[model samples]
Target: MAGALLGALLLLELLGGGDGKNEELRLYHHLFDNYDPERRPVKEPEDTVTVTLKVTLTNLISLNEKEETLTTSVWIGVDWQDYRLNFSKDDFGGIETLRVPSELVWLPEIVLENNIDGQFGVAYDANVLVYEGGYLSWLPPAIYRSSCAVEVTYFPFDWQNCSLVFRSQTYNAGEVEFVFGVDEEGETISNIDIDTEAYTENGEWAIDFCPGLIHHHGGSADDPGGIDVVYTLIIRRKPLFYTINIIVPCVLISGLVLLAYFLPAQAGGQKCTVSINVLLAQTVFLFLIAQKTPETSLSVPMLGRYLIFVMVVATIIVVNCVIVLNLSLRTPTTHAASPRLRHVLLELLPRLLGSRAPPEPPRAASPPRRASSVGLLLRAEELILKKPRSELVFEGQRHRHGPWTAALCQSLGAAAPEVRCCVDAVNFVAESTRDQEASGEEVSDWVRMGKALDNVCFWAALVLFGVGSSLIFLGGYFNQVPELPYPPCM
Candidate 1:
């Protein structure tokens, strides 16, 4: 009976332990809290990602006072996921809040761990919800309680050398490790890299710890939080290809064009051709540039601007050619100049200006034609001499005149009397020319006119080349700063 009584007491003790609190704990195992059915979809797998990355930087906002929050923005790569987050005013030490879209959030299974301290930590607010999805099976948010300490090794006391930096570490999981690369199942994440390294570290010193937003995504048990990451804050200037490729080349080419003045126009088409050829070569390079770059409707690139300028200059050159040709065509008399102005201008001016005298002219424009005509006439005269004097005369002369008279006429005609007529004409022309020369110092006005025209052509071509090049080179002074102080989409 005492044993039974002890058993009953033992059963009662067990019954008492099963109370409301215990039942509540048991039920909680199957139930969930803080359920968000409307949570955002995960971000990843987009051909192009667009982000409004604003990196606000402030330096020693009054060094006497304690350093406050300084906010900034930056864009991650396009391949990564994009996330939009809001930052509060007190976040960067006490500057304005910056709203930014982080392109890095687009990657697969990223985990973000925040460990900030004090009221500054409370003031800092970041939203890391999903923005888009190319993958499924995303893990729910997890809160891990831990203290964070950030020790900046070489924090710049002055804002002059400060910059924002974003560092990333990527990992893969069990099954993923076997198939592709960077064994994700391993403890250390593979392929952790900084995307902006190409632009920020080329021998320039800067200081600005611009705070950036961090984004992360995690997978479920089937997918299993395969990646971990860490990010560092850095500040830097965006890459500016316009300054290097476009502005520099345009300036250089323009300077070369301005040198056109140094080339003599009488150099015969070479000066003009050189300028045009340079412009043409630039155009070819421009074509190559266009082919290799992405097509965008956004503002044109600096290189494109340079190309347009060169093409315009090339057109101007064509116009200058017309002008030079016109000058060369000008005559000493009113619109009566022959094409010989090219030679006359090339010749007379240098000699007139105390340079060497002009080259002598060819005896005639074409020597063969004159020689052929003269040879024919001489052959006909020889044939006439071989014939009898009677046969050479008119038909009636043989019957109407005596043989003696005919003989006399033939002797006079054949004995070079006709040659004297040509000689007389030549002598008359020589005397008239000689008299003109004696009166006016023997100068050909045509030759003088040509020289003056060549000088005009040379100067005109030079001016056109100079003006066009100058406008393009000086154009940099007229450029306005970009509306967004960041790099554009590739």
Candidate 2:
């Protein structure tokens, strides 16, 4: 008897649950039996349907600077009143909410207006939530690719203001009104809502501000007005990636240009080579920057301008290298050093450049009289005295005085001519030696002038490089992101 009673109670409970489910099915059919999804669920045709739009930012997918597009993932919450879907809860087991297919109800046909790929609607057809008080809410997830104009003036350290515009495609401003959603405290929110728990942070970008604004377009004779909600997402680039990969390398390479000037002028080949390499590196960096930014002629990036400045400096260094090399290889025979050039390069400039002048060549010494010539004369005199009277006879005539008398006259007259010839030979050799020495000294002075010019150029390049680099990069170092993405209305 106890088992039979228990079985009977269980059967009755199952039957009662089945009847409740049947009533719920009857409610679904009753709501959609005469419902026309194409018609707006309003009592009057002129009545405006106010839609409250709220966005839950899920992820910042990517921002393509080259294409000027922003791809994001968000959940669009759209809420409005629908008089046709309303019901009395007491007639259907007190059901307060029902989840029904979104196709069986009227939709606002809201879409992304500034989409780049022409895909405007939500990604999924998700169910609609209907309440007993004729209120409908739809939360659909969408991946939007919206157009965002990029301002690369301070790129890699710049912040961008990108917007996602939403509007009703099938309704005009007179028939639809857009409003921002309210928070739990009933205050209208002006900014995009971030779901911290579900939001995934982007690697290269950081969110700064995301404000939503409602705009009303007034109708004209030919154009119909519409209501739109604009959600502006302001994001700043992380900068770490670009700084490490592009900026740091470029700075280090530009420093090499200064080192090229520091090198001695004798190494003109090496100096020119270094400058050319730096120029090539800047070219490569410019190409890399171009790839990352859009192709626009309105403004050049700060980094690009810096690269161009460095290239210009490098080109100047290369030209200076040619001048230094030409001066180095100059010779007095080929290119004479003028009086003014000599004074500047060898005298005044050398002193200013902290260099010493080339030493003057030593004067050639006068040749000493040969003792052998004197010995030759003395030997001739002795030989004349020893000679017979006949051998010493002059013009075959005997001397009336003595043998020594004739020999003395003969030796004096003949030896005087030989001594004159020896003196003339010595004088000629001395003059030739002095002339060679002077030529050598002139050649050395020209070489000294080349070195002096090199010193002057080195210091000049150093100063110019220092000043140019400081001016170019200082502005970037002090660059700061603005507090607001756009200017506030006056």
Query: Which candidate leads the pack in lDDT?
Result: 2
- What does candidate 1's lDDT look like per residue over 1-490, in tens digits? 3245335545655777445433332222212122222233224432222222222122112111112222222222212222222222232233232211122223332223332122112122233333222211122222222222221111111112222222222433322221111224643212222235333332222322322323334667655444222233332322244446654665566546434434443343665776676687677767755663335444444446556766676566545554554554444344554456544554555555455545665665654444435544555576566754333442223334756775665566558666546656776899989887643422344334434644554455556556754664455444423234323221
Off by more than 4 A, model 2 = 1-20, 220-224, 346-444, 477-479, 485-490
How high is the CA lDDT of each candidate model?
Answer: 0.39, 0.79
TM-score of each: 0.33, 0.77
Q: Compute the lDDT for candidate 2.
A: 0.79
lDDT of 2 by residue, 191-307 (tens): 788878889999998887888899878778665588889988888889899889998999899878878756665678998899998999999999999888899998788889888
Task: Count clashes in each candidate, considering only residues at least 3 apart in sequence or on different chains.
Answer: 30, 0
RMSD of each: 21.3, 9.9
